[model samples]
Target chain A: MQDREKAFIRALVRSNATFGIGDDGVEISNFVVANDAFFEDVHFKRAWGSLESIVEKCFVVNLSDIYAMNAIPRFCLLMLTLPTDFKEVGKLAKIIGNCALKHKVKIIGGDTIAGDKLHFSLTFLGQRQKSRILTRQSIKKGDILGYMNPSSVLTHTKTQAFGKNTKILKTALRFHQHRKIQSNTRFAKPILYPKMLLELNSIARAGMDISDGIFMELPRLSHLNRLGFKVFKPKGDWLYAPEEYQMLYAIPKNKLKKMQNFAKKHRHSFVPFAKAVRGKYRESKKNWHT
Target chain B: MQDREKAFIRALVRSNATFGIGDDGVEISNFVVANDAFFEDVHFKRAWGSLESIVEKCFVVNLSDIYAMNAIPRFCLLMLTLPTDFKEVGKLAKIIGNCALKHKVKIIGGDTIAGDKLHFSLTFLGQRQKSRILTRQSIKKGDILGYMNPSSVLTHTKTQAFGKNTKILKTALRFHQHRKIQSNTRFAKPILYPKMLLELNSIARAGMDISDGIFMELPRLSHLNRLGFKVFKPKGDWLYAPEEYQMLYAIPKNKLKKMQNFAKKHRHSFVPFAKAVRGKYRESKKNWHT
Candidate 1:
């Protein structure tokens, strides 16, 4: 989180109104409500891709939160702001409706208005897992932190396409000229593993979708779990690459073998890079989200 | 609704994903979920009021939907976008938290980001009434359409405060100079009647919050109920005034006396201005909402 957002949320924490403010999505009885905003120039630009692809990424980002919690998304409400002269209103509605139908989520209701920039704020209602809801607070002091990454071939291609440790803004600008951005590029149709997340629900102690990169999410998990992390050097550009939409999980020492086996069978890499310890841990670098 | 929005929603009506798109809020089992977007230059301007008052209006507008459905609001999730250089982040959070607390709504999780303009998209989860859920589709032919208005004193003052049928944009600019807009002014802390709405829940057959003025809303009711309205010539500036946040209800002819008595007891005027008929009714004026 950005410092300003963190400070703002700290003040909100003082009020009784804040009940489930720190999780991926707040659990309300059998449902989980998650919301995310995608604003023009801040999150994406029209030059980056087609409107269909842009809309798809917005839906995928919100769906990641639901799947990370082992929940099935059921309903969707969209608050869309379009430029006054922007045509293709019907196409926008078609894309949104088709995406909801593809996910089996009902488009219940929302409000749309005209504005200077395009903005979409989507609220997703997901049916919670019947037995348990995975959250970030359940990690233990000795839990091992692992993250789901794409296959080795895709990772190698991504590394070559964007170069190691290159900021996303530069890559997005470079790829925009080609007009053929590979799906492996960050923020281009993020890959989510729902089935693996469901399997890990029985083994992992806690988990969340990594949108703000591992460098930023680790401190949040550390604060929530009241434990520090014994960090290990990551092999590639995965540490600070934002918008992965992949799951970061904390697995107990005993269930480590089972989790590894599940990831291997699913053909996904689960790279363990940290272990929870006694002291606090903070990222030295500033957040790129702001 | 604007012409573009009407066309956009008409296309969405084709998909099975759209279940309850024509109501104040979508009823999902026991909960009613409503979402609305407030954007700078579109909904409100920073120069029009203090930040606290602007934020309060955002919450009140969403709450109006919940009360219009006769549901009790339970939770709120906010997607807020602030300018990069804007300060007072903590103050914004406090006002939001306090507003939720005052309304007895829990502040759940949401997303916040920095952008070029201020934007807020609020989602409210409300518990549906146990006995029934009020909707716009239940109005029957021969039903008398009534609206809840402020008492005579406030109405008279409001009539003189902003001249009858004056455009809101010009009035807002003129009022912005004085910096002392009355609470009765449109979009300036709208007055809601929850107790009276609950009382009318049993007497009125259909109801909805009038956000896009009575002229625009009446056609929506006509389209939903497949009946026309014999609209009375309104006495004052009420018909074309947008952002009133008042309730427009459809009551049976036999229950008009009971509804009036209840409104009198509550010190609100129930103005019966229309009756459902077989012929269609269309407002000639273009929608001011766009």
Candidate 2:
């Protein structure tokens, strides 16, 4: 395509396409869930990543959502945009099915669309006990912030933090760990991340998955409590981003030891990012006296 | 486009672009309602349709759905594949949002691509009283089949049924009886064939809004029941094709009179479609009538 043609396509992508879907306007269950993710060229590009990694990364990104609500996902509705090169639909299905099954989730429903790039969306629903439900508006002042992840958190979502480190936006491709999936889509074991379910119950004051970034996310969590956070220590291969959608929760001070112990039992990582303090958002940021 | 390109685009439109969402997916409280309509060359001047109509029609079709479901529609996700002239993003959103706001729906989400002819897929979601909802599954076998609109009844969404009716589809271009708005999107509502909300909880038997021919729809309801039907007479614009989804449900045998009385109170067009019989689906066909 020529300059004008490429510009036309770029404009088409940026200014919403010929189709538009309504946002969250319907009544849903307390823990209702919906997720969407994109892969290369259209959203990112394979020239910088591999398809298997792309698929695995997609799973983690969406699963980050179930972790956010602290709900166990039951079913997922997938909307997949297939590129012309992907002729083996059956193989792709098995790839997705195996990945989801290992997480104790199912690919019960989804859609497939053929497009220039690989993009997929999942509209899934899961349940949370009515009393244990988490929402953005639930954090209270004096609550403590908890960040969980096995190691580094990398996700191919529109996160803001890792962009400065990797110099890429909208994807967390570990070009350093690239490998080819043979013509056959087979993998020996499941690709697992900071497995953080079964550890969050009554402990979290409020929480959200950090698809955006730990940098932008901590501030968001702190705002919930009419508070500010002093993120004391930033650990792990922080610069090595993978699909790190570990849980970020605001827990009461009293529950710290208990939540950490619970994390230990499940072999999940847990860390204290900052404390919820009462103050203006900017004041807290400036005085984030870690 | 070459023959291969045209054929490829056609397949994509049917299977992917407008992948019948609600019927095939993991069922939720249908957040995104759907409506798909097709008109040949006459629906618009050959070149005028563009990708915009693909977006607009999905909104239009689903606006009727939001009404049918007794919900205030809020958002729509559209999918469209167009021929060469489909690049005007601003123009597309202009028409879509105009039609959407009339129903108070917004243009929050979107997707698009290229194709030979114009095909539109609109998925919309809205909010309504959980208790006062409507669906064909709730209709009883003996309940009455009422024509809410004395105006029109084109029950098929099939191409052939829609193909023979350009004269009726042309009515869309003329100013409709519905209110006209100054927002760039004007309207001649497609002779909206609406069902009454008040009729939902009434004594009506299993009901469906008529989509495919009453001939096609009633039998499906029969299959749902151990009952069969004997339609002595059919109602509405029989010459016209089915206009999107317009199915109503069957009346329970015991409550037919009460349903009739209820229909009368609400001013519903409850014509007795057919009487239930214990027969095979083939026998229910108009030609196979006893």
Candidate 3:
């Protein structure tokens, strides 16, 4: 069913589509329309966070699509289906409103209904100058493939927080026991760099926000452009790790230095992980799990 | 939780909002954004009809919101969350695509995910010329209230085909057994008259598509305008019956005749059921049940 779903959606892509089903969002005219669905068990368990964190994450995940296209998000429509037995509807709305306010995205409209499980669908409307919009179709062979590496907070929080002293190790054991709470507080949120990306949009040919891991998205980018990728640092299982809201981009090799300087100026980091190659969707000779 | 949800949404309605949470959709900058959710057991069952009919109904219901505002639908973003075990994904996509093609509305983007239950959310983007937009805020006290009556096919199909005679009654039972099949085929479809409504947009002040029965919508329209309604013919239970795709409007008393003529010319029917009155939010003095 999943394979059939992909094939069906691919068949519906139209010529006017700037980004189709496989990409982060779809662009038409000057606007980008994207919707993301987060289910209870699929995306998060109740024990993972508070209702506020869950609501905030929903906004972040949906807005990430607009940011991936280097577009300025303007408005959002949130549709929430809640279980009949659930409470705290007001808290969820308050958190969502706060998130929207912080991001300057207006909550224009939505629908709320009672269902068997908790589900949220947020549709984001964003705009970008036509020439500045990024898509997966414009990648050329030899363009540098780069990724916004997971932020230090996300990476450090996922590892043990303390080093190897016996006394500290005993205390770290207690802290590690509370790691789930700490991790949810810091790393469950989406990282957005819309303004920075918009400033650098001209330097990149095509890009996508990584939600379904780098391995899955690389083939999609390659399939769309009739090209292949060669990863240089393919020595870890990070290729399959879910990076959620990180982004992958195809940059011209000549502009890599400029982008690096701009990233430094903005205090952002872009790691060059792969390079586009002329072939039929083949990966590098290096194994993904070396 | 339901009450809290309503209160929370009402609190978020901004000053510039033409219609907010309680209305059919929201209007901003000449475009109306609306989203509707249809769930498996709550909206339809597998025994109700074919998958094609279900998919078609989804488009019709979403498009009706644009028609209610006398706007031209431009684009749609669909979000479907289907059970992992479900098949027939391709057929669902095909029907949705055909419906969009027929309506001249572009299916720009969408998301499909796996969920525990079957759910579909459609966000419609529609536009109206600034002068042609209809909103609840413009309704006047003395305006005439009108509705697009449910078509004969939707009405008569609800009653027994045979009125009198034992011979006919025996055959009617067998025919009635098949009525569910027929009703699902014809009445379950959404009826849209966007072009005609756009032509008549000037005559209407405030309007909304009737999805949650006329009785329910009447109170909402009245509450929004701080006025009341007086129904002339209040003895029928049609007020409570779910007329999924009909429209209700507030027209000026003087323009009622012109609207009637226009409806005739367009092969549409406008039934004037009530009048806007200066009072608190109350229904007609006439009883709803005879």
Return the top candidate by DockQ: 1
DockQ of 2: 0.10
Arrange candidates by lDDT, highest first: which order? 1, 3, 2
User: Please, what are the lDDT tens digits per residue for candidate 2 over residues B1-290?
Assistant: 12232233344333332222233222245453433323223133333334444445445555665555555566554444344654564555455555655556644433344444443444455555454554545443344454333322332222222222333444444543342212212221232333444345444433444443455555455655545666655443441334434435455666656655665564444555566666634323221100
- For candidate 2, lDDT tens digit of each residue in A179-285? 33221111111123434453474578777665444564554455434667665666433323322455677788889898888876665456776676666444211
Pairs that clash in candidate 3:
none
Alpha-carbon deviation at B264 in model 1, angstroms: 1.4
Clash count in backbone of candidate 2: 63
Predicted complex 3: CAPRI docking category: acceptable
Q: Kindly list the per-residue Cα lDDT of model 1 for residues A1-290, writing each as its tens digit.
A: 56777787888877666888788798887898999888776777777778888888998899989888878889999888878778888888888788889878898888888778778889999998776888888888888998876665555354422213336555675665455455546566665557777887667889898887788888888888889999775545677767778888899988888888888877776788899999787876776554
Please report, as a value between 0 and 1, the fraction of native contacts recovered by candidate 1. 0.80
Q: Give all candidate RMSDs, comma-separated.
A: 2.8, 10.4, 6.6
Deviation (Å) of A120 in candidate 3: 0.3
Question: Ten residues in a row with the worst lDDT in model 3 chain A?
Answer: A160-169
- Itemize residue pairs with steric clashes in candidate 1: none
What lDDT tens digits, residue by residue, belong to model 3 across residues B1-290? 24545665754553222125555667655578788887776655554566767777777888888777777788888887767777766666666777778777887677777776668898988876666666666788889887765344433343421111122323333444243344322235555667677767777887777665576667668777888888886545446544346667788999999988887676667888888898755443221110
| Best of the candidates, TM-score | 1
Which segments of candidate 1 are over 4 A away from where they belong? A152-169, A173-180, A184-186, A233-236, B152-170, B173-180, B183-186, B233-236
Provide per-model DockQ scores: 0.72, 0.10, 0.33
